[model samples]
Target: MTTNTLDADLALRLAVEDLYADYVHTIDDDRLEEWPGLFTEDGIYRVTTRENHDNGLPLAMVYCDGRGMMADRISALRTANIYEPHVYCHVLSAVRILGASGGVIRARSNFSVLRTMQEGDTSLFAVGRTFDTLVEEGGRLRFRERLAVLDSRRVDTLLVIPV
Candidate 1:
């Protein structure tokens, strides 16, 4: 249950990367329910465009505080939502673990979301950096807070799946 300084650092970095990868894959797979499992029970997940969160609009394109709210999001997507059917592919790089504070680990990485539709239309939907906090929970590393600050705010409606 003990990690040396070097091992802790490496593991923490790898864990965050794995989480980020799984994040992209899960959305691509349309596994909305399992997506929330990547977060801690008490985690916070927010999706906001730079214009909004920066201008103090006090609104997020999407915001879920706690696993329950995330779960609600998935539910809405599955049963109560309708939108253009598309596929998503996320490309990430430049991941840097800033440091740790108390029980929280801070990290940032670049992300690009590419989408394709059934009719063969493809485009870059969003590009951004994932700002996250991580911690050990349920015997695993999980996100305690995740903010997807997008570079593209032209959300084409129905961000049912977490970006």
Candidate 2:
């Protein structure tokens, strides 16, 4: 590719990179309402086991389509969700665009989630890849779909945010 083409891809990649980073921040800060704003009105969010995906079984820990569903998630989290005493720190790496269709750009990235409790304990809660579809809208990129394929099942506590 020419330098211009490369630069274009890089720019787009960086934008998505920052979005991924901001996503981690939003989840960590418990800004759940703002979390859904990162996505499009018809966006999708899901977290599933790699085993289930590989086996072609449709099972997921969190699955939502559209901002309304995402809103409901936030409501449930704030008003109804409960979990063990711990905080999750998520780190994302190796973000790259895998493909695209129309305005949608599909991407993948590796992620590691670290957990800490009030008892002065810490450990790796889960590690996996985040598969996402982004679209450029109103001169900005937004998530149209995101699938956090966690490698670890039998989670210790509740997963209330996107990984």
Candidate 3:
């Protein structure tokens, strides 16, 4: 590749990585309101089991079809949902950029979340692989779609938070 081409590729990779970092930090820091900003205005987010995904089932544990819906979810979590107080620590592997086309970048990453309760007990909450479609909007990378496929079908507690 030409020097300019190589530099562009590296820049794109770094941008995508930065997006991932920002996403996890937003959730981990209890800045849930900001989570919707990580996506495009009409972005889609879904959480489902690997079994469901592999079986081509349309069911999702959590589904938000747009930024508006995502924002509403956060609002409901803050005001309406009742569950034990807890925090999440997300560990993400390197993003594997599958390809880019029509200004969209397709990528995947493996993730594990640790949940800590108010009483200071911690446990593994979930493990998953995220398949994402990203695009640059107003000079920043944002998720056009984020599909989190959990490795297991069972969740130990209420899953109000985004994974």
Candidates' lDDT values, in order? 0.84, 0.84, 0.96
Winning candidate number (TM-score): 3
Models 1 onward score TM values of: 0.89, 0.91, 0.98
Candidate 2 at residue 4, lDDT? Answer: 100
Whose lDDT is greatest here?
Answer: 3
* Winner by TM-score between candidate 2 and candidate 1: 2
Per-residue error for 12 in candidate 1, Å, reads 1.9
Model 1 scores a C-alpha lDDT of 0.84
RMSD of each: 2.7, 1.6, 0.7
Per-residue C-alpha lDDT of model 3 across residues 73-97, encoded as one tens digit per residue: 9999999999999999999996899
Model 1: how far residue 27 lies from native, Å: 1.4
Model 3 bad stretches (over 4 Å): none
- For candidate 1, write residues 22-134 as lDDT tens digits: 88788888887898899998889999988876787768878898999999988987788888778888888898888887867898889888888879998888898788888
